[model samples]
Target chain A: MSLSENLFYFLSFLAIFSALMVVFAKNPIHSVLYLILVFFALTGHYILLNAQFLAIVNIIVYAGAIMVLFLFVIMFLNLKKEGDISAKSVFVKVAGVVSGGLLLLVMIASLKSLEPYQLKADIKTDIGLVENLGKVLYNDFLLPFELASILFLAAMVGAVMLGKRESGERNF
Target chain B: MVEIITKIPLEYYIILASVLFCIGVIGVLIRRNALIIFMCVELMLNAVNMLFIAFSAYRGDASGQVFVFFIMAVAAAEVAVGLAIIVMIYRNTRSVDVGELNKLRY
Candidate 1:
């Protein structure tokens, strides 16, 4: 195996392991930390794919911002003891695992039939660079870019409104 | 770089992403904490992103990378609103457990 293939296997292992940890960790904070590790492993995969811009953005947006938000919420809630938080019935747990395993098997079977093809000659190599990506973003995707900003604005307003403590009579 | 990338078959990525997505699904189904479930959803999104970037590089197309950008933006917005809702739930219910918040399940 070449160096690149080795790197890919290592990164995939890290990502899968950390993702499992995120699910099984007793403390919510530990889950958040494991999620961060998964993101870092994903960033490594992005880099291996020659997507430098995406790798950096993944680090900045996911690991830097979103996870910190998660950590803040976990800490603010002060969930010191997470006793018996998962489902109690053994049947439900078994059913969930069975369903998820079935889904994985189906997806793998479908992907196994795909034929690998050689890269096309017209394929551009520098597209993953920041300059080329920026050109396409501003020139071809200008409208969607603006729309995304609007979406962010709406989300910010909605979050603030939902989180504001009520002072008047409660209406449930 | 593209040649080196194509040396590894795309099917490997497909398998990796499928596993990650299933892990996310199992996490959502089995875990009771709303915050942990939300994190699992993010995990699923990352799996999709990895697939997108892999295909984009394989095809030598930049559009898939751009799509990943949009996915990231949407994820950020979703997390903002979702976490705020989770915090509100905690304030009113004194717990982050989803099983206990069934007041609307009449």
Candidate 2:
């Protein structure tokens, strides 16, 4: 195996392991930490795939912003109480695992039937760089790009509306 | 650098992404904490993003990458609104457990 393949294997293992930890960790804070690690490994995968712009954006948006939001909510809620009825019944847990495993199997099976195609020589070279990505984003995808801004604005307004304390309530 | 990625078949990426997505699904189904389920949803999104980048690189098209960019944008917005809703629920019930907040059901 070459260096790149070894790196891919290592990164995939880290990502999968941390992703599992994100689900299974007892403390919500630990789950957030694991999710950050998963994002980091994903960033490495993006870099390996030559999507430099995406790698940086993934790190900034996911690890930096989203994970921080999760951590803040977790800490603010003070969810450290013990003996809460957090555990699901065994039947439910087993059903979840079985169904999820079946989904994975079906997806992989479908993928195996696809015809193999040769990698295009000139295609994978540097199209993922910020310069080329920007050109395409501005030209072909300009409309969607502008619409995303509007989505952000609406989300911000909705969040503020939902989170604000009522005028007459002082339950804290 | 292209040789490195090309040496590994695209199917590997497909399988990896599928596994990650399945883990996310399982996490969502079993976890009671709304915050943890939210994190699982993010995991599923990342899995899809990885597949997009991989396919884009394989086909030598920037459109896939652009799609990934939009997915990230939508995910960010979703997180903001969803977290705010979670915070509101917690304030009213003093718990982040989804099972505790089923008052809306008929």
Candidate 3:
């Protein structure tokens, strides 16, 4: 009945629709585009939840950086062939959808008993603010925060190694 | 004295995330393209992240948001490495389809 609730439903619809399109699109590039829309809808949800920092990060990392990388890969591969549309058998596709639907049914049924969790009286409501989370990230999660740099370094080196062409490779 | 987020129940979010996750699973199962499967995995990760954020907001805990941040970092690292591996496979096999690659030695 409220404006925020309306926005929430609209965004949820947008996200769900885009996600389905991402799976059903024949071209990988189209899928990437649809995925960007999905990420944008998620960002809207984050904003609605008042997680301002997470909202920005979701847009920057997912919609901006990751989707761009996916687009680049798709373009390089030129995977617009029609043959991919029929990649799986009809029976396999039906089974996949049926199993996925069963999983959804089970999760929703189990979630029906979830007791509502209220915010503690003493808990600060502004915990999602960048200032607060940054403080907590450095203070309590300092070790893990610092260690992520190592993970990034390893990933960078590994990507480079895996992507590089060997001597006399004759192919990229 | 809690900041009421919206009229929407937290269950709605949980259900939304679950549906997104199921869509990702179905995509992984039905799609033979390694790239599509990888994108579906990203979708699943995002579903979990959104759920985490919802819980964080509802419970007024910063830890959940911090965990989501860490998950994003790990996802970025994973995408970099996974895409590189996919590229190498594509280079050798000339196709990104998982069904075509039957042999482990290739």
Top candidate on lDDT is 2
| Cα lDDT of model 1 by residue, B12-97, tens digit | 88899999999999999988999999999999999999999988988888999999999999999999999999988888777889
Of the candidates shown, which would achieve the greatest TM-score relative to the real structure? 2
- Candidate 2 local lDDT, A48-88, one digit each (tens): 89999999999999999998999998888888773454678
Candidates 2 and 3, the one with greater lDDT: 2
Relative to the true structure, how large is the alpha-carbon lDDT of every model? Answer: 0.90, 0.91, 0.89
- Model 1's lDDT to the true fold? 0.90
Clashes of 1: 0
Better of 1 and 2 by lDDT: 2
- Ranking the candidates on DockQ from highest down gives 2, 1, 3
Give each candidate's fraction of reference contacts reproduced.
0.69, 0.76, 0.60
Per-residue lDDT, model 3, residue A165, is: 90
Worst 10 residues of 2 chain A by lDDT: A78-87
lDDT of 3 by residue, B1-106 (tens): 1233646778899999999999999999999889889999999999999999988987788999999999999999999999999999888878898987878767
- TM-scores for the candidates: 0.96, 0.97, 0.94
Q: For candidate 3, lDDT tens digit of each residue in A94-156?
A: 999999999999999998687875545565578888999999999999999999999999999
Error of 1 at A88 (Å): 3.1
